[model samples]
Target: MASGEERYQEFAPPPALRPFVRTIWTYAAPDPSRTIQRIAPDGCPELVFDLGAPYAEQGEDGVFRLQPPALFAGQMTRPLVMHPTGPTELVAVRFEPDGARDFLGFPLSAATDRRLDMVERLAGFAPPPGDPAGQVAAFVAWLEDQRRRTVWWIDPVVRAEITAAETEAPAPTPASARAASAQRALQRRFADRVGVSPRLLRSIFRFRRVFDHAAHPGEDVEGWLEAGLQAGYFDQPQMARDFRRFLGCTATDWARDQHALARAIASQARVAS
Candidate 1:
């Protein structure tokens, strides 16, 4: 993170593209440090175009390499650590849950945990401009043509299964024999379209829900227990395990840390809650 105030802004795309694009954001970290940003899953995929200094993605092997200027990151089940070398500016699009599959012209499951270049994936497309606003216009032009020719390949059963899974929370998952068959079909189709198991998606949502609780004006054992329960965890132990699993940090440690992601999540979660 930059010591100096950073400029972070977000804008909606053209109305015609609203269904696919969640938002396009621009971040200008003019006075960047070697800040390590920890990214967690929010059940959405993204396309980020770097317009400033390049950043690196820390590998599982403890190595860090500069990320591609333009990359398509799929449904992330684990955390990603990013390190910026200097001043950094980013133009990024956070896609709607099912949006990336259609816009990217490929099943999302194939892209999980991978960083890819748009030019390599799609022909006749070049790297973007130096400005965020300009890049967006260029992207829109590319997408307009794609929208007319590309056909969405999602399976009907996969859609229904996901719908059921998303809605099943306050309710129980299906138990009937027919429902079991549907579940199996859903799993196969979903894996085809989204690339992750329904069970994994559920876990992502569960872990992310705790971000809101970090903003809750509570603390200690009692607050942790309540927060875990609210986030759909059966108990503190489960939530604690998840914090370690995805973030590699304990729940309490994360709460006490000074990170932009956690702070922003807390702020947004408060408003949403």
Candidate 2:
């Protein structure tokens, strides 16, 4: 792929901001000539600051539109394929399921499947060129300034259930009369603050778990099926259905294709500069 290679790294958030931020990261796609990467929903929202060449997004209508250098790319219900105009570099913040509502100071509904410019939204926080670390640090300062003004719209129980569900916990069902009441309350709070039902979030993460568990490099067909079942699938057939619904491919094909789920977002490519 020449210098069109992708290079990426992840960082932990500062302790004070750990409650809202998931992982901070920087990705560089040097000399990204004509290649574009496919980005799918991993059940999380992000704020991206592109510091290199801009990329073009392919719409459902088959048109390619240039993406803003700094923008809030909201939660996606489906896949997005972006075409790189040239070399690309970006620093990003991955937020927890219910984190962006307070961190970004807007309802999740307004940002879903949309791109809102960061400079216009944040007010005077423009990032200088080639400074990935500084970009994230500045956002941290903004968050710190607004820390006291944050509203606790999401209940702690709701946040806990969301975190559990995202980490591959089984979905809540009718356990008992009292337990069901608590479950319903959490579900309602989740939908209000997170903008989706808890069940849907659980399903998304569950699908992702199958892919992560099944991804064994250079494995044979039987190895693939065993991995999928081990990842909590009922059987091979159930896993195939999930792959089709979430990934538009069979589990067998997914294993053979060598497309890691991380490609849907970023990668740790070592480019030959």
Candidate 3:
């Protein structure tokens, strides 16, 4: 982690076609009195560095709680709990699922996908706390180098299929025709690249979107449901199941909890007790 005295390093994603997959630098002040935690029910993976603090990672408990200045480069297949000791600072590369696959050189299903979990494999790598800045600088330099290289590494046939699907703009027919065409193209692309059809992905995406929207008082549920439907769920039941999978709760319950948590964050600057 770079010290407050050293400099706060922030990296923004380049502007272009794949804007959503941008990797940015994140920083925080060192505070001995505070802990930072994150949880992911949807199985989103991340790359992080643990500067050099004592930390504990819970196994078989479905939760990972860490005490920092430790550096880690890993993926979270389940929920995680993190704590920072003495106001730590660190650089993280956050990636979406597809972008993560591109960056990691392995599919998400690969057991050895996490770099930190196989520390021995990362032999000759930088040590923790003392060299995070150099590590991040090296990563940024590498990403810049890769940016000048090729695009879309899938097989030629798969790339053709992807290009065709993305080109299938909504037809000029009736509303249903446009919707059906768009849905079909998205489904094909998702199956080819993401290993899941757009129908399933949209259900998950919609459920997550609804939860995020309803994470406040006086939110409109009916409107949220309509939005979910537009995002391609067969109906509300499918969407609800998605909520259960990623959030470990029904839609309504998850919304309430998020709202309460947000209120607490805004009120006293506290983490979950």
Candidate 4:
């Protein structure tokens, strides 16, 4: 088995593509253990091109379905559980929160929690044939071509909401009447473009910060009370609630269990930034 560091790598997008593409990443696990991996939600959609043995995702019914070689993974509100079928190699594009809509030319809400075959969803799309690096280059070129042919526009309100959700500013107060009204208007457009409501996106963003805090050098569960506060949680219980909601476990339990593979991928992959 490759070490976590060797198993994953992330590459930045070109300047012109940065606004739409968050990052391109590759993961290879040639001899993975028979352990199920739980991937937490991060409010971004992905285009995955599997180059080696496929992985199987567990559906809500608890049945596992083999993933397609090339597929679009839409925004997920709950954790996704998957186990390897054999050796695995994947090169994937992580799109910005609202970027997939412009590329897919459909309402992202239609894709939430769904993985659509890329070739079926996007005409003429296919998994680029090459090694990981060459595949990434080919995919980026394809994306650039698509950008030129497509007329793309992002809603300003959604942009502002994403910015506010990702900020480290103090937990926001209750919304004002006018702000609430504006949020209602934004929710429809946000859901159409981003696959989740603005409030849900904010919750997911805040939930991700808990991991960031726990990852800091010398931080541990002993200090999670403070970590939770810094992560915009009102208290440890509030943080624990979110941890349970998103991870299906308490923070302490999650730490004790040591989900190494999931942690490694989450730490290395810049899904939304």
Which of the numbered candidates is closest to the native, going by highest TM-score?
4
Could you give the C-alpha RMSD of every candidate to the true structure, in order shown?
Answer: 3.7, 4.6, 8.3, 3.3
- Per-residue CA lDDT of candidate 1, range 162-241, in tens? 55545544323453544777778766666667768877877877787775566544467787787679767898788888
What lDDT score belongs to each candidate, Candidate 1 first?
Answer: 0.68, 0.65, 0.44, 0.76
Greater TM-score among 2 and 3 belongs to: 2
lDDT of 2 by residue, 157-186 (tens): 768777677656644443254476787776
RMSD of 4: 3.3
Please report, as a residue range, the 10-residue window in candidate 2 with the lowest summed lDDT.
264-273
When 1 and 3 are scored with lDDT, the better candidate is 1
Candidate 2 residue spans exceeding 4 A from truth: 1-5, 152-154, 170-185, 213-217, 250-273
> What are the runs in model 1 whose C-alpha is more than 4 Å off?
1-3, 119-138, 153-181, 215-221, 258-273
Candidate 3 has what TM-score? Answer: 0.52
Residue 256, candidate 4: C-alpha displacement in angstroms: 4.3
Each candidate structure's TM-score, on Cα atoms with residue i matched to residue i, is 0.80, 0.79, 0.52, 0.86
Candidate 4 lands at a TM-score of 0.86
What is the clash tally of candidate 1? Answer: 1
User: Which candidate number maximizes lDDT?
Assistant: 4
Better of 2 and 4 by TM-score: 4
Displacement of residue 164 (Cα, Å) in model 2 is 2.8
Model 2 global lDDT (CA atoms, 0 to 1)? 0.65
The candidate, 1 or 4, that scores higher on TM-score is: 4
